[model samples]
Target: MSRRKVGLWYRLAAALTRPPMMMLFRRDWRGRHHIPATGGFMVVVNHNSSLDPVAYGHYQYSTGRVPRFLAKSSLFTNGAVGAMLRRTGQIPVPRGTKDVRDALKAAVSAVNGGEGVVFYPEGTLTRDPDLWPMAGRTGAARVALRTRCPVIPVAQWGAHRVLPPYQKKPRIFPRTTHQVLAGPALDLSSYYGRAVTPALLGEVTDVFMGAITDLLAEIRGEPAPAIRQRTGREHPHGLPSVSGRS
Candidate 1:
């Protein structure tokens, strides 16, 4: 598989961040072959830790693909930081506003343009007490179905130990392992060209999230709960409600 083109910003960011990440954690990653060697695709992942994006990006980067992540809009408010994010191909999402459509449209555009787009299907940290994936929003589904692109399901664990949800500081004393598994692209061809409706979107969301939960279960070696815990209201971009969480 040919490597995707890497921009200067992404290259610089990786050079600065990769070494510390390597120093702080060990990796138990698998299923690299599941990521398409060439073409646009969406990576739907389970969100547990704030640090998992770096962890997951490392895994994908190792596969020679640069991933464009949907990040909170506030992160892009800083002038220099925002410029770097835009250059690095990160999509800014404004949660709870009508502007979310812009984010979703950008995601679809990214995929159609032969880039890898990463979506945290839960939109926020797992509200589940056990750190299992909560109910997913339909933003990813909307994009996937809209583009008819391959949606790869990935699951990651252990980054939460380093930086638990909503924590300001990380505990990196003992190096931890970030375990990630990438499953094959989901088979959503049957739903191609179907009318987009709420019920259809919900059904599609379940299919994608179910694939991610199953992969996490494989990583954890445990059965997932039949019912995922509901967190809050969802946006078109799959973000949790903006009242409390980012």
Candidate 2:
């Protein structure tokens, strides 16, 4: 398939999001060159505040790359909104589906189609009180390995200050500085031929989150905590059973 470019939906989003980003926040975006000019890859980001999506999405878009995200199936099940999401090439994964493989498959397909996909290894806003990246889910590592794509770790901060997770409204006036930094693609060569299991996946997943955390540490000018907060599972109610199995 010919490489897909940004469509009307992305442009519309840019129109709406870029202005507020510019007017309400100062930017410290860096290392955008890490975003490939072409081809398939994964950009795994840390989830902090609710606005991190916009902040991180803008981080990628500003690099002149349109991102294909894996959103909830419900978002694509609506009428007009669903139509637009499909038109925009956003993949939908039915939450709580018995076959989680389907979701990973769709994401891998997106990358193989020459489109970049963004994964939040934590799968939700960090519940960590201080906003450090919690222990990540295996989804990010699974997709990257299955697709054999470069997994670029992206770290972003200051969005939490602008709009704290679950905060009903974002503070607008003071102009918070949203900092986004992109790190080099992770080196997974050591495990290329290893058996695909939860243990191996967990190892790579930790590395993925660590890369983001290291960059975040740089952005914040502090040392990243030595150990990842063992916040079970990516979801609040439970950690997906796939994490500990071999």
- Top model number, TM-score: 1
Question: Whole-model Cα lDDT per candidate?
Answer: 0.86, 0.79
Off by over 4 Å in 2: 77-84, 232-246
Clashing pairs in 2: 233-239
- Report the Cα lDDT for residue 76, model 2: 85
- Candidate 1 local Cα displacement, residue 148, angstroms: 0.7
lDDT tens digits by residue: candidate 1, 134-186: 88999999999999988999999888878886676988878888899999889
- How well is each residue in 109-161 modelled by candidate 2, as lDDT tens digits? 87898888988888777766567788898987888777788889999888777
Model 1 weakest 10-residue run by lDDT:
237-246
Per-residue error at 242 for model 1, in Å?
23
Kindly provide the TM-score of model 2 when superposed on the true structure, using C-alpha atoms.
0.88
Candidate 2 weakest ten by summed lDDT: 237-246
